[model samples]
Target chain A: MQDIYILFQVAGVGIIVAIIHTVLKQMGKEDIAHWATLIGFIIVLVIVIDYLSRLFNQIKSVFILQMIL
Target chain B: MGSILQLFVIIMVAAMLVIIVREQNESISFLLVLLLGIFVFLFVLNQVEQLFNLFQSIVSKFDVSLLHLDTMIKVIGVAYLTEFISQLLKDAQLNSVAVKVEIVGKLFILLLALPIFISVLETLMSFIPQ
Candidate 1:
């Protein structure tokens, strides 16, 4: 339910970032275009990482696995 | 049933989106895929947690020890988490790392199963000994 929204959000971010990168490149700001992509990557990574941690916590709480990572 | 259909639709849409975005930004495309994978896993994970809670209650009804069930749950958890990570690495094109992650997961599962193994061995020994 809520999870699907995050999926769309990521896809939207990716598409938006792609558009920005290309538009920036066409404007001759190749460096800024690169930075945009990098920043987009980091933003996506942060979102994914936040969820990843939540997932780990959920697993820990549910299974209570002693050898959990 | 409905959720499965929903998941299928989501995956299909996400796949097409990946194809659409792949041309412009490979990294973002990959990120989109990664996020989708995690979402799908988490969706199923919620169901699994519910199922496990049910199992816990059912097991409590029996007079048997819970140690085995606890081990089984741990093994299942370990297997799922590691497989999810390895698959993510595979998606990222790190075959070697994926394989290592899988192997380590199997090793951890084996380590967790040692008590069950010992119990089985003891039973066999009881049957064969003088």
Candidate 2:
């Protein structure tokens, strides 16, 4: 349940960022728009990295991959 | 099955979102696809565990050595992990790197199976008439 919510949060951030970027660029603020997109990507990436770590741990436990990790 | 249906719906929605984002930001679209791939794998992980457990139980009933069973499992795991990573790399446009990774995986699997190969050879050698 919680996982689904986090996914939605990331998706929402992406959509919002895309909107903000397009709006800013329309106003002739290309640099600001680029920064906004980059920040959005970083935020989503942070969340994704956390999820990926959890996934890796789960894989380690499931596969008993003591040596590889 | 119901959960699979739910996953399908989620994936469809995510695909739509990715398509929408493609025109705006290509990298973000790629990220979305990558995230969806991970999500799908996570969703099916429990099934994978169940399958492994079933295989273990079935193999235990046989007279095969535990070492062989363990090696078999490890080889399967390595193959799967390698395929997954290589596919991701290919999706990221790293074709040459993906090919190298696959070669590495094949070599690792071969190494893991060496003990089994030795056992087979010894058994065959013992069949010769003294």
Candidate 3:
């Protein structure tokens, strides 16, 4: 459920970043476009890291019972 | 069914977007594909949970020792987690790192199965002349 939302958010970010990069490049601001893309990548990476941490926690909780025995 | 349809739609959209972006930015396209892969796995996670619950119920009715069952579950979990991580690594083009991760996973699984192996060896030894 929440995962679906996160996926959409990531896709949105990717598309928006790509658009910004193209627009900035067309305007002869290649450096700023590059920076925008990098920032977008970092933001997406942060979101993915958050999701991965949640997944790891879930996995730990699920296997904790098995670990005790 | 509905969720699967939704996932299919999302993947289709993401794939088209990746193709469009690939001309301009290769890494971002790759990242989009990676994210889609993760989402697809998560979409099936509910089924995995149900399967685990079924295993629990079935195992509970048997006379098997809880220790053995625990070890079995742990081994399966280890396999699953290792596969997931290894696939992610492969997606990132870290092939060697992915192989290392798989080797480590196999080692951990082997360690987990050691108790069962020892018990089987003991049972076999009991039938020996020595």
Candidate 4:
């Protein structure tokens, strides 16, 4: 639902960042392109972590088992 | 909701492919192509819940214990995704790394299924009337 909107936004931002990085690299800006790639990955990872945390909380509430080994 | 999102992903990918095949700048177009593929992947993830529910229903129709089914699914998921990742690594020309990763994944999956194998052996022993 609302989460889908977040997903779309994250995907869109990632694509834009990739395009920027590619354009910069083609213009011989290797350093900036590398930084941009790192930033894009971090942004995507942040979204992933947020999504995983939400799922973890939901699963914890649903399952009372303390076995995580 | 999930299907609509999937439709959007397909459209974007198709557009990106068209752009890549006709475009002169292969590197930039390739990067865009990669971005589109990743974006579609991210979008398809929103359907994970639907997939889980469908799996749940299919598992319910079987006579197998739910926990066993879950474990089986977990192992399968790990194996299948590892295969995907290893292939991607190979495509990137990291064949040695991919081989190592595949070996590690196979070992992990074997370990994961150990309990099930042990339980089956125990059941067989009981039937032998030791």
Leading candidate by lDDT? 1
Q: How big is the RMSD of model 3?
A: 3.1
Give the C-alpha miss distance for residue B114 in model 3, angstroms.
Answer: 1.6
Tens digits of lDDT, candidate 2, B18-129: 7777777767766777687778878877788898888788778875556676777778778877887899889879999999999999998898889999999999999998
Model 3 earns a TM-score of 0.80
- lDDT of candidate 4 at residue A12, scale 0 to 100: 60
Flag the better candidate by DockQ, 2 or 4: 2
iRMS (Å) per candidate: 1.5, 1.8, 2.8, 7.8
Better candidate by DockQ, 2 or 3: 2
Distance from true location, Cα of B117 in model 2, Å: 2.3
What level of docking quality does candidate 2 show?
acceptable
RMSD per candidate (Å) reads 1.9, 2.5, 3.1, 6.6
The numbered model that scores best in TM-score is 1
Predicted candidate 1 versus true structure: per-residue lDDT over A22-61, tens digit per residue: 8998999999999999998899889888887877788887
- The order of the candidates by TM-score, greatest first, is 1, 2, 3, 4
Mind giving the per-residue lDDT tens digits that candidate 1 earns over B21-72?
A: 7887788788788777777877788898889888888888775566689888
* Candidate 3 per-residue C-alpha lDDT over B29-112 given as tens digits, one digit per residue, 9 for 90 to 100: 666676776666665665777877777787787845565876787787788889988997897789999999999999989999
Give candidate 1 regions above 4 Å deviation. B65-67
DockQ of 4: 0.12
